[model samples]
Target: CIILQIIPSFGLPAGLFLVLLIGIDRLLSVYFPIFYKFKNVRRYLMYHGLAIICYALLQYSFAYVYFEDRNVICGPPEIYQGKAKALWGSLSFTVIILSVILYYAVWRKLKNTPSMANDHRLFRSILAIMGVLILGWLLTITMFVLVVFLLDWRGLFSNIHLQSL
Candidate 1:
């Protein structure tokens, strides 16, 4: 049960970071095609793999803050609240915003470069996937912010009134 709870806490931020990584990969490929192509594959993989490991460790620290109390019910409504939720939300929001900027830059670069016409399909697919992810996160964060502001935290989490409705 604890592992199940930890899975989402670990996965959500990691997944968001992965999307941002993809954006970075696209941005570099578009802006520095020669450098990107000639870079050693093993070195790049090693760097990115190390980055993932470091990021996971950082997120694990944040998760420690959130899970410090060990609530009886391990769901979001029970576990996520106040400062911990706000911190995670802000981090996720920042990643999404950065991703949008990166992808937009990539799109513009791709559009202006007639020489790279053949790569449009690949860029389009990445753009599409990121678009869906961005929208989903926006909606989720919007609702979370609304819920946080519109109702008292206790009412939303503890009272059981929301479940009735």
Candidate 2:
């Protein structure tokens, strides 16, 4: 119970960072046609690496400055918490949406360009990675959400019993 309260002090930010990174990657793929055109795969990777570091910094800042305290409490403001929650929920779902779009787009293009057989191998790898990423995140979200809800339910039940007594 106690840890649950403290966890989002770190977890939400980390998760958000990942969500953001994935979002950026998708954005680049969709909108930035020249994204990998420089022939410098290393630079592409470096930029991606920078995005990750940016996420880490922002995540830590959000956790420490907004959520954490010395008293080991875990909570967000009644109103603002909703906003924060919405941001994450929305971001995650958007990623899922983009995943669907990407899958379809890739499939469609590959189907149209049958001569690019080697490209299919690359597509398979990308799909596999994306699938794994999605599953991992879903599991993580489910675990955290369930834990939080159950703890809250227990707390609520305890309070109810105390009041009844």
Candidate 3:
């Protein structure tokens, strides 16, 4: 139970952060090919370091909150439950929107390139990959929304019961 709660706190944020990085990388390569090509190792290392810091912060915060109660089956106490879902949902939506924008930019760029103009295979592959990624994120966002709604509904009912007592 403890492990389950701890893993997602770090894992989901890191995974979403990687998606954002990929989108940014794709946009950079597309719009500023020369700059992307000329980017030094230090710049790349700095981006990686930032990602690490974000992951560490998420992990420590979640662990600190959940560690005080060993009986928590799968998440923080009721008071903190909906917050995680909301946070993940927002992140997923942001990633989805960024991916859409980046994919559209790549498509437009590819369409205008003489060499890639007739290459249906490359376009098809890119579209397929993007479709998969978008679908996955959409699924995650849907689940998070549902969980948050359900948790809130349950909390409301529990509160009513407490008032009655």
**Number of clashes in every candidate structure?**
0, 0, 0
- TM-score of each model, in listed order: 0.78, 0.51, 0.64
- Give lDDT for model 1: 0.73
- Considering every candidate listed, which one attains the maximal lDDT? 1
Better model by TM-score, 1 or 3? 1
Residue pairs in collision within model 2: none
Off by over 4 Å in 2: 1-37, 70-100, 142-165
Candidate 2 whole-model C-alpha lDDT, 0 to 1 = 0.53
**Cα RMSD, each candidate:** 3.9, 6.8, 5.7
Model 3 residue runs over 4 Å out of place are 2-5, 55-80, 116-127, 146-165
Residue 114 of model 3, lDDT score? 62
Query: Given candidate 2, what's the lDDT at residue 136?
Result: 76
lDDT of 3 by residue, 15-102 (tens): 6566556666766776787988899969796977688568546644544564444344464222123354355466556666777777
CA lDDT, candidate 1, residue 16:
75
lDDT of 2 by residue, 5-61 (tens): 444534544454554455445545534547635447788668767765665454444
Local accuracy of candidate 1 as per-residue lDDT tens digits, 1-165: 235666666666677788888889999998998999999989888887777666655665655666555556666334455566666666666777888899899999988988655578878888998989888987887677666656666555555766777
